[model samples]
Target: MPDSKLRLPPEAVKKQHSLVWRIILYFALSSITLSVIVGMVLATWNYHRQTEAFQSRLDYIEAGYTESLGSSLWFYDETQIHTQVKGIMNLEDISYVRVTDNLNLDIETGTRPHHQDIKTIELVYKNKPLGNLQVAFDRQAVLTEASQTAIMMIIAQLASLLLLTSLLVFVVHRLITSRIRDMALEVNERIDSNSSEALSIPESAVHDEIDILIHAFNTLSEKMNNELKQKTRAQQQLKQVNSELEDRVEERTQSLQTTIDELNHALKALNKTQGKLIEAEKLSALGGMVAGISHEINTPLGLCITIHSYIDDHYQQLKSGFDSGQITKQDFSDFVAIMDESLGIMDKNLQRAAHLIKSFKQVSEDQTGEHIRDFSVKDYLNEILETLSPKFKKTRHQVHIDCSEHMRMSTYPGAISQVMTNLLMNSLIHGFENKEQGNINILIAEEKGNAVIRYSDDGKGLNEEAKQKIFDPFYTTKRGQGGTGLGMHLVYNIVNQRLQGDITIEKDCGCEGACFRLIIPKKLDVSDS
Candidate 1:
C-alpha cells in the first residue's frame, strides 16, 4: 500500500558510485536533515504565537465586561444576563460567549444548550468576577494554522538544503575525484596492455597529487625502456669487442709461429751447410785414397790391361794358329777359358765403381732441386724411389708406390719429392733398422672425390711413445747416426699446414704397422705457400 513498504534493489540501498549520483545523494540527505531541524523549531514557534494571541483576546473581553458592570448591587436577572452574553457571542473573531451573574453564581449561554463546562464557570463567577475569563475558544483554526506552517517550513528547509548540498558536491567532484578517476583509468589501461607509451592526461586533469603520479609513471616507463635498450646495445658492443680481441690474439700467435718457422728453416740451412762441408771433406779424402790406391792397383791394372791388349792382339793369331794346326785342340781351349774368366772380373770391378759414384751423385743432386712441376705423380715419385734404389738395396728394404697413372695435378713437385725422399730414408734408417727385411708401402689414390695418400711399414711398427711425437720438429726415434729427425715433421707440415689437406693416423689393430691416411684435395691451391 505504501512506497516505504516496497522492496528496494541492492544497488538502490547501496552507496552511490558516479559523481553525479553521489551529488544527488548528498543533496537529498542534507536537505532531509536540515528540514527535520527546521520543522522542530517551527513547531515550537507556532505553538508560542498561538498561545500569546489567544491569551490577549481573553484578557480584552474580561476587561470590557468588568467596566460595563458599574456599581449596581448585583441584581441582574438571569434572563437579562443571558441576553447580554448572547450579544457578545455575535462579535467577529470570537468563537463562544457566556455570562455568569457575579453575586447569584448563575451561568447563561446565548439560548443554545451547551456541554457542562458552563456549570463549573458559574460556581467560580458567583463567588467572584475576579478570576480568569470563563470562556474557551474553538482553537481548531490555531491547530490548522500550526499544522500548515510546519508543512511549509519543512518544504522550504528541504529545498534550501538540497541546493547547498548540490553546490558542495559539484565543487568537490570537479576539484578532486573527477581528475583522479581519469588518471586511474589511464594507468589501468596501460598496465593491462603492458605498453611503454606515456599516458596523455588532460591539462585540466593535471592537478596536485594526480598530476605528479602521471608524470612519475610516464618517466618511469620511459626510463625502463631506455635502460633495456641500452643494456641490449651494450651486450652487442661487448660481443664485438670480444671478437676483436680474439682476432688480435690469433694474429699475434700467427706472427709468433712465422718467426719460429723462419728459425727452423735457418737451422735446416745450417744443417745442410754442415752436411755439404762433411761431404766435401769426404770427397777430398776419397780423392786422396783413390790416388794412393790407384798407385797400388796400377801395376796389376796395367798387367791386366796389357794382358787383355795382348790377348786382343793375339786372339786372331791364336785362332789362325788353331786353324793352321799350330796348337793342339786341348791347349787352345784351356787358354781361351782362363783368359775369358780374368777379363770378366776386371770389367765387373770398373762398372761397380762407376755405379757407386753415380748413386751418390744422384742423392746430392736430388737434395738441390726444389723446382715444382705438374709431372705425372706416379712417374715423378717413382723416379725418386729409383734414385734411392742403392740405399734400399744395402738395407734390403722393400718399397711400393701405388699412385694411379694419369692422376695429374699442379703442386710443388719439390715438396713431394723431398717428402718421399725423407720418408724412405726415415724407414731405412729407423723403421727397418733392426729388421733384416723391411717393407714400406705407399699408396696414393682417389677415394670419395679426395686424393688419399697412405704410408705404412711392416718393419717394426712405430713405438707408441715415438708415434705421438713423430711429427714434432727435431723429434725422432732414430739416433743421429742414420737420421736428421725432421722427416715426419716436414711431411706433417707439407700435408696439413701448407697444403690445406687433412691427415690422420689410421686406426690400426696395431697390425697395419704405422699407417697414416692423408686426405688431400685433388687440386692443390698454391696460395698457402
Candidate 2:
C-alpha cells in the first residue's frame, strides 16, 4: 500500500499517540476490530447453519418429488413431472428444479438463480439408477440476513466497548492523573512561595507509589530547610563579626590618627622653641661683645685724657713765659718746640681714641642693625675681628683675615657681619674647644659677581656627621655645656637667606680644619628677603 502509515505527519502521529488520547483510541480501535472479527465469525456460522437446514429440507422434498415424478416418467406422463418440479420451485430459495428419465428426456421448472448455485441429485428406483435432478438456491436472502446479523453484533459489541473504555479512562484519571496533578500543583506552590513550611499531600487510608514519592520529597525538603536555616544563622553571625571588626578597626585608626596629630603639634612647638633659642644665643653673644668693646674703649679714653692733661700744662707754662718777657729766644723756641711736641702727642692720642671708637661703633652697628651699604671687604673684616677680640684674648688662638682690600660689595652689611661673627665664635668655642692655640683664617674674594668667603680654623675639625648637621638648628656637640647650637645655623641662614647665596663645607679645600665656603651676591636682591 504505498507506505500510507509513514506518510502521516509527525505532529499528527504524536497527537495520535498521546497518552490519554492513545489510550482511548487504542481501546476504541481494539474493541471495534475485535467486534468486527467476532461478528464476522458468528454471522458466517449462523448463515452456514441456516443454509444447511434449508438444503436438508430441500433434499427431502426433492427425494419425494423425484419418486413421484420418476413413476410418472416411467408411464411417460409429462404432466406429473411438471407438477412435482413446479411444487419444488415454489419453495423458498429454490430458484430452479429439474428432473430427467432413463431415455434422456428432461423436464424443468423455474430459471436457476445462478449456474454456480445449483445443487444436483440422482434418483434411483429399487436400487437401480432412474434419472437425475438439479436445483439452485437463491443466495441473496441469506447474505442479507447474515449482513444484518453482523451489523447488529458489531453495534452491540462497540457500545459495550465504548462504555467499558469510558469507565476505565475515568477510573485511571481519578486514581492516578488527578493525584499527579495535585502533587505537581503542590510542588509548584512550594517553589513559588519559598516558604519554610513543608509540602503536604492529603493521604488516604490506602497508600500508593505517589505517597512514597511525596514522603521522599518531604524528607528532602526538611533537610534543605534545615540547611537553609543553618546558613542563615551563620550569615548573621558573620555579619555581626564583620561589624565588630569594622568598629575595632575604625577605633584603632582613630587612635593612631590622634597620636599622629599630637606628635605633629609637639613637633611644631619644638621647632618654634628652637628658633627662639637661636635668637637668644645671638643676643647673648652680642652682650658679650658689648662688654668687651666697653673694656677696649676705656684704654683709648685713658690715653687721650692723659695726653690732654700734659698738653694743657705745657700750654699754660709757655703762655706764662711768653707774656712776662722773661723768656730768652732759646727758651721761647724750646717752649714752642715743647708746645708743638705736646700738641703732636695730644693729636696722636685723640686720633687713636677716635679710630678705636669708630671701629667699635661700625662693628656694633653692623652686628645690631640691618642695612645694605658699600664696605671694603678687608676693612670690614678687620673691624669684625677687632670687635671679637675679647673671645680670642683669653686664649692663644689668633684670627687672620685675607682679602682684596679694594674689593667692596654693595650688600647687607649687618647680615654679613653677623654671619662672620657667628662663624668666628663657632670656631672659637667648638673648633678650638680644648686647644691652647688655634689659627682662624677668613679669606674673602670676588667671584662671578658674588663675594666668596672661605673661613677655616687650624683646630680640631668636625667629623662627617658634624659637618653634615653643622647647619641644622639645635644640633649641638656640646649640649649640656650651654652650647645653644645656633651659631653655625645662624651663619647659614644669614648667608643663604639674607645674602641670597649658598654656603658649603668645602671638604676638598686641603685644610686640616673644617673649611666653610660662603658665596654671597655682591648686590643682594633685598626683595627676596
Task: List runs of model 1 lying over 4 Å from the truth.
Answer: 1-366, 447-451, 479-483, 496-503, 519-529
How well does candidate 2 score on lDDT at residue 290? 83
Tens-digit lDDT track for model 1 on 189-240?
Answer: 6766887778787554436766777778789989988988999999999999
Instruction: Find the number of clashing residue pairs for candidate 2.
Output: 0
Best by TM-score: 2
- The parts of candidate 2 lying over 4 Å away from their true place are 1-238, 245-272, 308-343, 393-395
Q: What is the lDDT of residue 105 in candidate 2?
A: 83
TM-scores for all predictions: 0.36, 0.49
Colliding residue pairs in candidate 2: none
* Local accuracy of candidate 2 as per-residue lDDT tens digits, 1-529: 0122443345434442355557778888888889999989988987897799778867788667767766776777787778778888788777677787678688777775766777777776667778888887767777788889999999998889878987977776677655665665666666668765656776666778877777778888889889999999999999999999999999999999999999999999998998788778778877888888777777767876876787678668777877997667787677678768777877776776677678778877777777788888888888877887766778999888888868998887878778888788878887887889989888888888988888899878999899889999878899999887788888888787778899999988888887988888887776876
TM-score of candidate 1 versus the correct structure, residues matched by position? 0.36
In angstroms, give how far residue 505 of model 1 lies from its true place.
2.7
